[model samples]
Target: MSSPAPPSGAAPTPSLLRPWPQFLDLSALSLPISLSEATYRLTQNLRYFLPNYVVITLLIFLVTLVSRPLSLILFLCIFAAWIYLVFLRDEPLTILDYDIDQKIILGLLAVMTLVALLWTKVWLKLLISLIIGAVIVLIHGILRAPEDSMEDSPYGSLLNVVDSPGGEHASV
Candidate 1:
């Protein structure tokens, strides 16, 4: 036998397990053509966007905290390599050499941060990493004297030679 239909004019009941609608129907979401319209839409969505922005900011802060130790270790390793190259390796020095090394370290730290965010939840790990990074930078800055200074600089010998009259005459 066929079941009787609900009475006319009554709303249909949604599924008990899934009370919300299935579709967001955002296919009509399009970029606004005019500046005024864009501003209006942005203002209208501020309530929705604000909470999401706050959540994202909090997550980023937590991730930075968690991944700080790894960042510090990477920084220290890079800093050690720099010192070795500049002081002991007898390598020819150039401004770009240090710049390139620093960039590589930063890139590695970024990757480590991303990995930490994905794999870990411990805040202690991140805090340690951050502390390590800060220490490495501080130490490196203190040890790595400026190259341009004529006196008491890492490149002082080279500068002295260049500044001496005999050296300039010899070069001419």
Candidate 2:
């Protein structure tokens, strides 16, 4: 079965999933001419599409964990800790009157998360998925040409692309 075609005059609306439809423009994708060019394009694309890359990596990790219930629970606990201590915290935390540094919390969380995930034995699968995601992002970043048509803009970047009329530069 297939859906009916749209009217000829209608400019088909872009999918909500693709905030910036132009970001995935195939015509803009091409092989870099030189090592320097590749490096430059990779850096630029990575910067510009960092949010998109993050989502891809997250999706990969989530998929890897779906088959392992225990790992999923452990991952959620670790993620909650990070979110509570870092992103959601409005001020420095105090333990026994001595203030705890955010950096220390981050370090400890990183070490603990690694140890816990590794101990779960599912780390291998998650790690491989993450690496694959990184590779895909890197390849695309290197190949996607720097768009000449897009202009620099400060608003509607990353997750806020739809907020502005034309968020040309989601990243610099």
Candidate 3:
């Protein structure tokens, strides 16, 4: 026999096995308007936003990796600032005889990241890594030979020139 239908105007009871129906309402989690509309907007503009977000995230990761020690110090300072602002509210936050506020804490973190990037030479490290990767790729390509003759292969002449002594003067 089929179960009785729910009373009119009452929400249908969700099954215990499918609890997500009760808790994960997309409409409830929407910003100001409809969740579907917001999602549509994001999808429509993804091509414009994704590449910039990826580049910025990669740059931040590189800077953080290069400035490991200083980043740790900066993290600790931010943590201390948080602790002072939230946990130890009874005491005023003071640094170097000046009162420290949210703006000051944020400014300090920004300055620290900038200083760390400069001090660690993140740009120089990035350039070196790129050069090394290119060199490795080139070396691998040069060492791997094709079955075709030097004249038939596209890179054959270039490889021969590089491998041969006094072949620098060879015409293109």
The TM-score between candidate 2 and the true structure equals: 0.58
Clashes of 3: 0
Per-residue alpha-carbon lDDT of model 3 for 1-172, expressed as tens digits?
Answer: 3446768998433211223332233433323133443444344323223333333334444455555666556545644554446444543566898766756666776676566557656655556655654454333223323223245444557758878877868377
Best-performing candidate as measured by lDDT? 2
Q: lDDT tens string, model 2, 1-172?
A: 3457779997534222234566778888988767867777888777667766766776688688888888888877887787678756666888998989988998999998889877988767877988999899989888888763133222214325565568556475
Would you list the C-alpha lDDT of every candidate in the order shown?
A: 0.44, 0.73, 0.47
Ten consecutive residues with minimal summed lDDT in candidate 2? 149-158
Q: Residues 103-138, candidate 1, lDDT per residue (tens digit)?
A: 554466567656655565545554564565545433
What ranking emerges by lDDT with the best candidate at the front? 2, 3, 1
What's the lDDT for residue 38 in model 2? 79
Q: Give me the runs in candidate 1 sitting further than 4 Å from their true place.
A: 1-28, 69-172
The TM-score measured for candidate 3 stands at: 0.26
Judged by lDDT relative to the true structure, which candidate is superior, 1 or 2? 2
* TM-scores of the models, in the order given: 0.24, 0.58, 0.26
